[model samples]
Target: MRIARMHLNESPFKPSRLVSSHVSKYVDKLNLYHVEELEAEFLKKLSSYTKLPRESISLYPGSSEALIALVRFCRSRALKLVSIWPSFHGFVEFANMEGVGVDFVYLTPESFELDLAKLTAVGSRSKALYLANPNNPTSNILFQDKDTLDFLSSRFGLVIVDEAYFEFSGYTAADGVLDYDNLVVVRTFSKAFSLAGARVGYVLTNQELSEEIGRYTALFSVSTTSLASALGALEDIDYMMEIVKKVIELREELKRDVEKLGLYALNSKTNFLFIKTPTLGRVLARSLSEKGIKIRAYNDRLIENYIRVSVSSREDNLRFTEALAALLRERSTVG
Candidate 1:
């Protein structure tokens, strides 16, 4: 049987040729401590790529670590965290570990869109809000414009926007960090840049907040190879976009294919699609696993009957589509 691991939201593409070359050149530096110059260079490249001021951005091993740091900050300050339900589970889990309280604003059932009104009603009472634009498991962009930023800006709390899928969605809150003192944007190179193993991510906010967060950033957390690879990825933006283009093409094809199988494949701006199954998601996940295909199964109340699959290469997508079609046909005939 063919094996397809589509559960993790990792890019099917590898890092750019330039990135590989850069990492190869630095292979000998594995034993030495990571230096500040490479970190500075990567940040410079990031600032140029994002058009944000250098001082406003801080790098981390990955967005998860950055999020952990933010959660610690929130915990220390007794900041009440608010987020959309069924979003990324990391921060909520971290908050739980820290014993900080979190308020969840549920999404609309059918559209899976953010309940801005409900969020607004609760925003003033919370201290920080986490908005995962192009949210995970749902794969939908909450807004096309800066409406989210504007909405949260009018409220009292700080806003943390996680744009881990930014390259695929092209919607970002990085610039909003400049416009709103209370806004912070977190991003990762793992998805589009194809550096999941390297574990590189960044946070963008005002200079004061950046410095405040800097105090929590551990020294030498990022390795030298990771820094060089990130720099190379930044230098070859076109290569990354090309891979993103291919992923988008395959993602649309997969959406249509899954819909043909009678599943509700949500429109996605990210490199994955969320499919609502006719039966329980875990049951469907088991059936797919029997065919040597893996997908993310959700158990949360809002997404209990849905499965999320990362968009893979053309061949892998075709294999998954075929396997799913066969499985659905068999189930229909059995019924």
Candidate 2:
């Protein structure tokens, strides 16, 4: 019984050959504390890939670290954190742990759209806003309108946009980094690049803010091997794009299949789907796990019936759909 691991939104494919070969060259260098030259080259490649100045970018072991750094910075400044409910829970949990006040604006239950007006009213110049563009668990882009984004960017003291799924969504606030000094766009190699294990991520912001945030991050936070992996991934953009194409295709196919089975599937811009299950999500998740398939189940009261599943290989997708159909049929018969 092979488990279909579709819980974390990880790439179904492996990293490109370039990533493996590049990382191999650095394996023997692990004895050293720092590899300055390799780090510089990685930053150079990253700056070029992002089309932002080198001073505008800062690397971290993972985007989660970068986010934690931001939360700490906010705490230092006495700035409260504002975000939508049922988003990347880790960040919210971290904020609470750090004693940073947080205010959440729930998305409309029907469409999963942000009520920007409510967000604007709740957030103020004294607070910082953190948004995951293609929101987690919902799989939809919440900040589609640039005017609304600009309004919020100006309204808030600091705005952090988590573009972890940027490659799949094909939308980013990276350019806004130039226009708004207070804007920070965080990205990762964990998703589309298939380098989740490498734990490489970066932040794009104005030079001034980048430097300010740099003060809070530890020196040489990203290791030599992780830097090599990220650099190789950037050098081979075509391979990453190919993976994204296949994942997007399969994601749509899976959504249609699930819909045909009478479950509601939300249109996704990322590699996962947010499905409204016919029963408790935890129960469905438990049944699927027992059958060697796994997915993310929400415990939040607002969306306890929703499950998030990653797009995997065709075979795995079929297995999931089949298991789901059997479970639904069994429930129907028992009812």
Candidate 3:
């Protein structure tokens, strides 16, 4: 039997065969020998796209590799990794995976905000702090909060901001790179570009650290295929933005759908929604699975019973809701 599956988190939806057609000529023009031009074009396009310094961007095979390298750099520099709880699991996972201890300051879900005063208390003893701009599960990004941004910029040895979902949020802390060497922005083609399979991502920082991280890394961190496709993805900003608009709109609609189930969704700027469930999150997840839907559930001591759902096209969206709605109706009847 085919098991029903729905990934209720932000991942690229499958693209049509025509997905790359939008940037055919752009990819066709690349010559592998002219590596400088390829790198230049990548930065030129990114610089134009994000208005970040052209020299500050460094490409990696994927965000995971970029993240691993960045975290390793902090440890090598004798800096402890600091993190905000409820960001991306990778931050803590990687730290322990690398055999280092990371201090995590848990944010209260009720406020859904950073506790900078507490972070300030814990930060000086720590070396680096990692956060997602619009964090993974809760999708609460607060860099615009002067207290959080100022505390981060002024004090930490490094603040790694994962902006993997920035396309949906329309925000960036990249400008801080010019002012502080401590700012490192990590991003990928996975979410916004529909290029997850391409394995393209970049870490944005001043030239010195980019050079440092690159010094001991693999020769071909990112493949030529990703390079070709990423350049293609960049040229199709119009198509990308069109999809982003639909995602944002659908996010609001899904929020309404979730709320109707007596579940409230966190305000999300990403394509996915973070929903607080009545059961340990999976109770509802399994209920929906039985009805032919799949969603992700998180098991954290801090926020138990939370799930992350990916936003897809209207048809997929409705399918997910229909399955979930059926599950809810059954529970109500049983009650």
Candidate 4:
């Protein structure tokens, strides 16, 4: 049986044809280091796309690199990383590796909503706040109101908002970057733009913060090919929008289908769904893997019964639902 790879929240569709064509032009020039002109052009296009000043933007190989640089910068200033519990695990791991202290304000269980009171209580202890809008694992937008985001921005010394799934969520903190000098937004082409392999991510913030974070990143870290891919993606925004629309539709369909099987599916704003499984997540994940389907399961105590699966094409989604149904039937029979 063919494997249905739905663990990682990757775009099911291939990138726009323009991305391939643009990368091809860089093949012969790989022998030479990428020129400043290439970087300048990429920034110009990105600035136009994001509607932010070019000075406010900085490029990196991936958003993870940009995030790590921010973590190191926070560490230098003796700031602890504060975030909601069960967020993107990689960011917390990065902080631990850098010896930066970390703190978490747990979301309300089941609903997974942010508790403002708990968050405020930690303000005195934490100077740096990292939030993944439409949070990972839970796949729900934590702060939907502008007032709350503004309050958090004012409370923290630095606030980094990861908008990796912005295309699907239709929300962004990038617009507030100039309004709040402490606000920083990170975006990537990996999901909606379908450029995971290209490794292009960028930061949006005030010019000063942008430059400071850029200092931590090495020079010319993004390859010429990746720049070309990002440029092409910007040129073909409509294609990316089309892909986002389809993924959102499929995500909703999958959510409904899973709910029909008597499982709880979190209302997701990203390309993946966070499902509350009837059985332990590990057992469900193992069973699904046996049927050539792969998904994400958490070992974190609070979310041990949850599984995350990326929205794929209709056929793959059907396969997932069918396998899940069979497992549920077997479990019911055994019970």
Clashes of each: 0, 0, 7, 0
Of 1 and 4, the candidate ranking higher by TM-score: 4
| Model 2 lDDT on a 0 to 1 scale | 0.90
After TM-score superposition, the amount by which residue 203's alpha carbon in candidate 1 deviates from its true location, in angstroms, is 0.2
Q: Where in model 4 is the C-alpha error above 4 Å?
A: none
Say what the RMSD of model 3 is.
2.8
Alpha-carbon shift of residue 46 in model 4 (angstroms) = 1.1
Question: Candidate 2 on 1-335: residue-level lDDT in tens?
Answer: 78898999999999999998898999999999799888888889888889998999999889988998899888877788998876899789878877776788888876888887788678788899888989897999987667867887888999999999999999888878888878999999999999999999899999988888877779988989899899889899999999999999999999999999989988899999999997999999999999999999988888898999999999999999999999999999999
Flag regions of model 2 displaced more than 4 Å: none
Query: Tens digits of per-residue lDDT for model 3 on 1-335?
Result: 34344463545455433446633634554455335666677779988887777778888888888888887888889888888887788777877888888778888656568876777787763478888888887876656654566678777878888999888888888777777778888998888777888888898888888788766357766755567678877877877887788778888987898898788788888878888866677787777677666777766766676877888766667777777777778777888
Report the CA-based lDDT of candidate 4 relative to the real structure. 0.89
For candidate 4, write residues 115-135 as lDDT tens digits. Answer: 888878887534898889989
Name the weakest run of 10 consecutive residues (lDDT summed) in model 4: 118-127
lDDT of each model, Cα atoms only? 0.85, 0.90, 0.76, 0.89
List model 1 lDDT by residue over 1-335, tens digit each: 77787998999988888888888878887888976677777888899888998999888999998988888787666678888877888778877876777888898987999887887788773478887988987899987677767888778468888999999999777878888888888999999999899899999999999888767769888889888999899989999999999999999999988887778888899999999887778887888899888899977767878889999988888888897788778878999
Per-residue error for 133 in candidate 4, Å, reads 0.2
